[model samples]
Structure formats: C-alpha cells, structure tokens
Target: MATLLLRFLLKAALAFLAVSVLWVGVYRFVPPPVTFTMLGDVIGGHGITKDWMSLSEMDPDMARAAIAGEDSRFCAHHGFDFRAIGNAALRNAKGGRIRGGSTISQQTAKNAFLFQGGGYVRKAFEAYFTVLIEALWPKRRIMEVYLNIAETGIGTYGANAGSIRYFHHDASRLSASEAGRIAAVLPLPKKRAAISPTGFVRRHGNTLSRRVATVRDQGLDACLR
Candidate 1:
C-alpha cells in the first residue's frame, strides 16, 4: 500500500514537470491566451480588458518607467533579487503588514503561470516557474510578457489597456509622465487611479517620470535593448 502511494506521488510530480515545461516552452513564442487573475476578474463581473502590445511597438519610456519604478536592477538579477528580498524581510520583521521582495521576473512568473496570493506552497511553485521562464525565455520576452499581462487597473490588464483607460491613448507613444502614472498604479491598481492621482501616488508617479530618463541614461533596461 505504501509503495503504491509513493508511485502515485512520483507520477504526479513527473506529470506536473512535463506539463509546466511544455507550457513555458510554448509561451516562449506565443502570447498567453488567459491567466487565472483575468478569469477571476471576469467572474467577478469586472470584465476583461487587455490590449497586447509588443515591446518594440511601445514607447521606450514605458519600459524605462517600469524599470525605474518596479525593479531598478531588472537587468542585473536572475529570477530573484536577494538584496531586495533581504530588505523586504527586514521591513516585514518589524511587522505592520507583510511585503514581498519579488522582482519583475518573479512577478512575471507568477502572473503568467500561477494564481494570485497563496502561502509557501504557491511560493514554491512561483519560484519553480520563475526558474523555468528565466531558462526558456529571453530577457526581452520576459519583459514583454510582464508588460502585457500585469494587472493595471480593476479588470484592466497591460500597459496599452491601462493607457487607453486612463490617458485615452495607447502605450505606443507614452510620454514620461503618462508612463510613470501607469507604472505607479501597478503596485495597487485596484486602489489607485492614474487619471487623478493624489498624495503618495501622485508624488511617486512624478518621481518615476524623472527616474525614467535616468533609467534610459544609465541603461538600466539594457537587457531589453
């Protein structure tokens, strides 16, 4: 009986590995059709809103703004940023609310492959998928997938959709300020609005706008280039 159970578990694990590898490999060239988060939004009646735009079609400032705001060392790190993780751990230790140290690559992995917000089990899967994408996809493809799939507003997904929803334009030609505003809403898209931001959101958007130029100047997104 114990041997049978062990065999079953081993088969299950192997099946998972094979399927996940195939999924990641296919997404290397094909844009993902849907994700768990998008489905949840649809179920909640928020409806799906996404406009897929290739990285090449987007204005350079948009990607630069993301690099400046979300992960300054996006080009430097592999799948994880240990320094940021260490900093987040220190902050969480003080214990107001938990924070994550996820890099854009890790976020991409989660957004692409897994459902949102779970405990250690989900995190282990997230890490595994992150490694898989980093191995199978190029840096540019990873950025493209993240930009296209990220939740930008309540039910809205991708920079182009967010741009149209907020700025009445697509992401094809976003200015620094516009890109910054969209990027600012990324951390808490449901709570924030790029149309009329105030307080920290406004300030952070402005900061990100300025940093966009710096990111370009410093070549922080060199990997995408």
Candidate 2:
C-alpha cells in the first residue's frame, strides 16, 4: 500500500511538471488570447477589444505606478516580500477583511498557472508556481507577463486593452497620472471604471502618483541593480 501511494505521488508530480513546462512554453511563444471568467463582463459592458504592449514600448509611468500600487518592493524582492506578507498576516489576525499578502510574483503565478478563486489550495499552488517562475524567468519577463495578464478593468479588459479603452491611447502613451488612475483601480477592477472618476479611485490615484514620483526620484533601476 505504501509503495502504491508513493507511486501515485510520483505520477502526480510528473503530471504537474509537464503541465508547468507546457504553460511556460505557450506563454513565451504563442500570442494566444487569455480568456477570464470575470473579463467577459468587463469587455461586454465597456465595448473594448484585446491588445498587447511590449516592454520596450510600455510607458515608464505605467510601470512605476504598477510598482507603487501592487508591490513597492518589487524591484528588490525575488518572488516574495516578507514584510508585506507579515503585514497581511497581522492584519488578518486583527480581523481585517482585506488581507492579501500576494506579491506581483504570486499574482503572476496564479494567473499563469491556475484559475481564479478557489481558496487556500489555489493560493498554495500559486505560491509554488511563484517560486518556479522566480527561478526560471527574469524580473523583466515576470513583470511583462503580469502587465499582460493582469485584469486591469472590469470586463475582459487587461492592461493593454484598458490602457487603450480608458485613455484612448496605447499603453506606451500613458502619462504618470493616467497610469496611476489605472493602477489605483486594480484592487477593485470589477467595481471601478478606469475612465470614470470616482472619489476612491481619485484618492488612490493620487497616492500612487506620489509613490511613482518617489520611485522615479529614488531611481527604480537602483533597486533592481
């Protein structure tokens, strides 16, 4: 029985490995359209289309704002941010409802590897994939994938689609404030519109804008270096 159990586990591990390799290959080579369960609503309601933006063409402002809003220590961390994770744990312990310690790496892992919303098991898988991605992919590649797959607006509007839909411009053309507004809506993309101004979005945008300026002034490249 023990031998049979071990064999089963080994097979499971091999299957997982094969799936991971296939996922990475598809992501790197195929410009396949990623469809999400939640994104369909956003696109249908907003009347937007799909698009992609390369890292070379992406606006520096959008990158900075994303760093500020999602992972302030992204340039310094490998796959996880201990400080943010600890803080999230403490907040959860204190009965805070908004307890997500996921880093940009973790989010990328979840998006790349699994479906949305399945509780702790999904989160565990996300962490596992996060470690794998950090080991196999560069920081730039990770960021690029995050920006490409991240749900930026309510319906099917990803970063590139959201950039064009809301701003009426390409991701490469986003200004600092415009980028901040988009980044601010990330936490609640399903509830917020990137184009329409809400009080919460405006306040968050301001906060992100300040962080972007600080990242710029302090030099984000220095952190990565």
Best by TM-score: 1
Clash pairs, candidate 2, are: 39-156, 42-154, 42-155, 43-155
lDDT of 2 at 93: 87
Q: Which ten residues in a row have the lowest lDDT in candidate 1?
A: 96-105
- Models 1 onward score TM values of 0.97, 0.87
Tens-place lDDT per residue, model 1, 1-225, is 999999999999999999999999999999999999999998888888999999999998888988888889999988899999999999999998687788899999999999998989999999999999999999999999999999999999999999999989899979999999999998898999998999878999999999998998898989988
TM-score of candidate 2 relative to the true fold: 0.87
The C-alpha stretches of model 2 lying farther than 4 A from their native spots are 29-32, 35-48, 95-97, 221-225
lDDT of each: 0.93, 0.77
Top lDDT hit: 1
Q: Where in model 1 is the C-alpha error above 4 Å?
A: 95-98
> What is the C-alpha local distance difference test score of candidate 2?
0.77
